[model samples]
Target: GIQVEQSPPDLILQEGANSTLRCNFSDSVNNLQWFHQNPWGQLINLFYIPSGTKQNGRLSATTVATERYSLLYISSSQTTDSGVYFCAVGRSSNTGKLIFGQGTTLQVKP
Candidate 1:
């Protein structure tokens, strides 16, 4: 079993600001994914960074499997970025079931 934790339980950012979200896991994992749940409760996949770093426009993520942690960086935050960010991990033995951690909720004010 693995445990996950996210920092900055609550965040407030002005529109166009930048923010960094962090996730820490207690054990080794084979799959790691980042998700953003909108105000309407729709979940969108942000990145599947089990290791190394990846960037998609204004969003980027990095995972260090050895250190058991991952990070999501949001550049130029927008009102659209206001939502709950979640980190999910799946073990190799598990059949694609992701264990999610408590999320970090971001509020971007215009």
Candidate 2:
């Protein structure tokens, strides 16, 4: 079984500011994904970086499998970024289900 944990339970970022969110896993994982839960509770997939780094627009993510940790970097924050960020990991036995952490709530104020 795999366990996930996220840091900085709460975060406040000014518009245009940059911030990084972190996620740590307890055991080896075959799949890792980052998600943003909007204020309305809609889950949006941000990235699926099992290893290495990836960037899309002002958001990027990096996963170091060897260290069992992952990072989500947000540049140029906006009001729309105000939400809860979650890190999910799936063990080898699971095909599509993910184990999600508590999450990091971000508040981007204008």
Candidate 3:
């Protein structure tokens, strides 16, 4: 079993600002994922970083599996970026079942 937690619980940013979000997990995991839940409740896949780092557009993520933690970076925030960011981890790599963190609620003001 794995436990996941997100730091800051909440965040507020102005458009064009930059921010960093963190996720921590207990125990080892074979699959690590990052997602963004929109205000309308749409879950969008952001990243799948079991280990190492990945970058896409204005977003990037890094996972240090050995330390059991991960980080998500958002550069030049926008109003469209307002949502809840989640980190999920799975004990079995092929299994879809995963433990999800409480999520970091982000609000990007215009």
Cα lDDT listed for each candidate: 0.94, 0.94, 0.95
C-alpha TM-score for every candidate: 0.96, 0.95, 0.97
Off by over 4 Å in 2: 93-95
lDDT of 2 by residue, 18-92 (tens): 999999999888889999999999999999888999999999999999999999999999999999999999875
Best by lDDT: 3
**Candidate 1 runs further than 4 Å off:** 93-95
Q: For model 1, how does the per-residue alpha-carbon lDDT over 16-107 read when each residue is reduced to its tens digit?
A: 99999999999899899999999999999999888999999999999999999999999999999999999999886353889999999999
lDDT of 3 by residue, 10-66 (tens): 999999999999999999999999999999999999999999999999999999999
Candidate 2 CA-lDDT value: 0.94
Clashes of each: 0, 0, 0
Per-residue lDDT, model 2, residue 29, is 87
The residue pairs in collision within model 1 are none
Q: Between prediction 2 and prediction 3, which has the larger TM-score?
A: 3
In candidate 3, how many clashes are counted?
0
CA RMSD of each candidate after superposition: 1.3, 1.3, 0.7
Looking at candidate 3, what is the lDDT of residue 110?
Answer: 94
How large an RMSD does model 3 have? 0.7
